[model samples]
Target: MSDLDSSTPLRSAVLHRDTHFIPKKAIGGKGSYIFLEDGTKFLDSTGGAAVSCLGHGHEGVQQAIKDQLDQISYCHSAFFGTNVTEELAQLLVDSTGGKLSKLFVVSSGSEAVEAALKLARQYFLELPAPQPDRTRFIARLPSYHGTTLGALGVGGHVMRRQPFEPLLAKNTSHVSPCYAYRGKKDGESDAEYVARLAAELDAEFQRVGPETVCAFIAEPVVGAALGCVPAVPGYFPAMKAVCKKYGALFILDEIMSGMGRCGTLHAWEQEDVVPDIQTIGKGLGGGYAPVSGILINDFIVETLDKGTGMFRHGQTYQGHPISCAAALAVQKVIKEESLLENVRNMGAYLEQQLRQHLGDHPYVGDIRGKGLFWGIEFVKDKTTKEPFDTKTRLSSLIQEKALQPEYAISLYGNPGTMDGVRGDHVILAPPYIVSKEEIDIIVDVTVKVLDEVFKGL
Candidate 1:
């Protein structure tokens, strides 16, 4: 490497997704908006990948973190326990209605996922009759778990996995995602489609040898990979049934769709089935702190307790006191303010606005999702439901336009919805604190962005 000279102008010291594509720095933010260093404000409709549930500048959360910092901020999980961490765990365990009775806190969603995977394997090994062969995992296609090695291996986003194919573990397999927009056959009823998907999952279990499979992982609502696609009625319970029959654990990755991001506190609450293991992040600390965790079902906790008497996995920063304190305050705000109810009421209003404005747009192929989480998938031909070519980068273009001076809005773009490389969509997940006026602004700006981008196409 050549030595750098002080005379030479330097590029961004921080590495972003594309080194050449340096984004403007956001200097300040308040509820539902972010202010760039240039003083341009953007309506934060996407909430930074749906993490800022409480939005920015909440005095209550800020105070909690400050209090935690004053008392104690760090502690090794293996050595000692903190009151904030204990309280947070109790709150989570109770939130699951005793179904998921244990909590394993981590620093991020990927770490939480890795913890869940390891816990599942350990659970099998600690069983009355050990199952060393139970090492395989089955997740859905076009699904995203996390960026870590094991999490990436279990994920099914083809484009993301291709470069790291040789490095990823080979024990994970994929099944079709429950994407009704394209996956449902013409003239198929909702019930028929759900049955077909459940059967396909059953077939995959058989093909992979049921006894060797440890768990089936999926997002209750497909997040970034499929642009917030929720399953049709009875789809989740049906899939859970197959896991039950095959003795495989049902692992729900709710990093994006859980913790009241959807209408319910847990996405599976609406699906009518509880998961054996669940990983959640993003909204957990409302972006105030880096925190994520795995919630273990009662039976799994019992199995490990009765056998190993210890969890074999841990992290130095697990259950960081400051993170737990921040999350505790965030959860308190949600419950005390009854934000879940707001999520439902506002979610309906947002959906109505999206339909009213974009429902008739020729390029808008599908609009689906629940609660505050919604997706608008674009297409080349509405009648054929054909996606734009990957090279067109339609979703990215719309995103770029939406952030321009005229629009001053932010949204989340996701490509590769049809397969792992051939579709485009954008997710709109405003903060739960969003008001009617904000929703109107989001819809109006979105319409302008879409029209400008596809004006000639």
Candidate 2:
């Protein structure tokens, strides 16, 4: 009667909804491939939610982590700071164009976003009365930063925010995200689209009372939400100008799209702008360990350094020695081995292969991305641009069916990607270490699987 019999898979694993169960255990991994318990290999196309930049396991990463364990295992930041922590902080600051004014290491992207929001609020409170009048934040809808309550409050994701609506922050406002495929008008030029979005942002700042806005947040490459949706040309520079005019901070969430996934160390580098507060994760430690952080600009960092003399915001694992060490190793390998070049080369090959294979498919509505980060949006009618019904779960079908022994590739994302629901898409952000041959295989298997699934429909 309990439905909890020993025969049930849930009895041992405690299954959750939206879970993917690959029969074989992923016992080990190396350079863009994961090995199952039985030794069957699965190419990690999505990098386990777009995290692993350097791929499965690297000698430099493992050795750095092991070296850290030899010296120190755990130490509170308040009590003491290790040499490696200071070194890693310096490295991040120097690498990030010398504008990473202050560094605060956290365990995840959500944590970094939460910290940034709180810091922004604190920046206002630190000001004298009648100060900047910045108490509100403006973000774009169809975006995600983190799942914690505060970060969730500012996020524009429909599905994740639905359950906790009443508990989220009210001061956060949302504008339309820069999704060229869905948001762009059919006849409007890209310039016109950028101008329209910039005007909308200006209007929101005014409606919120220009002086009362804290920051405008967005993902530079638009990962996870709209599926690798980059802003139209001149979008970010215009948006940044608006924020500067209002004296509000610009926050860019690069958790899923940064760390060299987009052919640059920082996606903003290609956007021709910099954020006042930026968040990075996923590829930071290359999944060898959990690590994420907020890279603040000089103005904000100096404000905190001078205003309160302390950030007041921190985490127990803010600068965990081992996590930082792993990330340091990850960054070193990325630089020394020059993996960003691979991202560019492999990305082009991937694009070409996908176009050759799926470019003309009836249901493949759109294929767009940068570097190794790409997404495939499915439509019921390509001519009309109509999306599949949300109930059909078309994205999940292809992902699940792709798990057949002969064709195993990881798919990342969910429904509601179109207007928060009523559409489907899947993202593939293979490791920067991916190869041309592997890219071809991924495209072939993906095409075969899509054909297999849609044939019955």
Number of the top-ranking candidate, with lDDT as the measure: 1
Superposition TM-score, candidate 1 onto the true structure: 0.97
* lDDT (tens digit, per residue) of candidate 1 on 133-186: 999999999999999999999999988888999999999999999999889999
Q: lDDT for model 1, please.
A: 0.91
> Per-residue CA lDDT of candidate 2, range 1-457, in tens?
1223345455336454524332445789988888876656888989988998888878878999999999997899989998877887888888786977677899999999998888887777765443556778899888888899988988898988999999998999999998988889989999999999999999999898998898899998887777887788899999999999988888998998998999998898886588888899998888988899988888777676667778778788988999899988899898999999999999999988888888899998989999999988888999888998877888778877776567878877567778775678889999998888888888888888888889867
lDDT of each: 0.91, 0.85
How many collisions between residues are there in candidate 1? 0
| TM-score result, candidate 2 | 0.95
Report backbone clashes per prediction.
0, 2
Candidate 2, residue 76: lDDT? 95
> Pairs clashing in candidate 1?
none
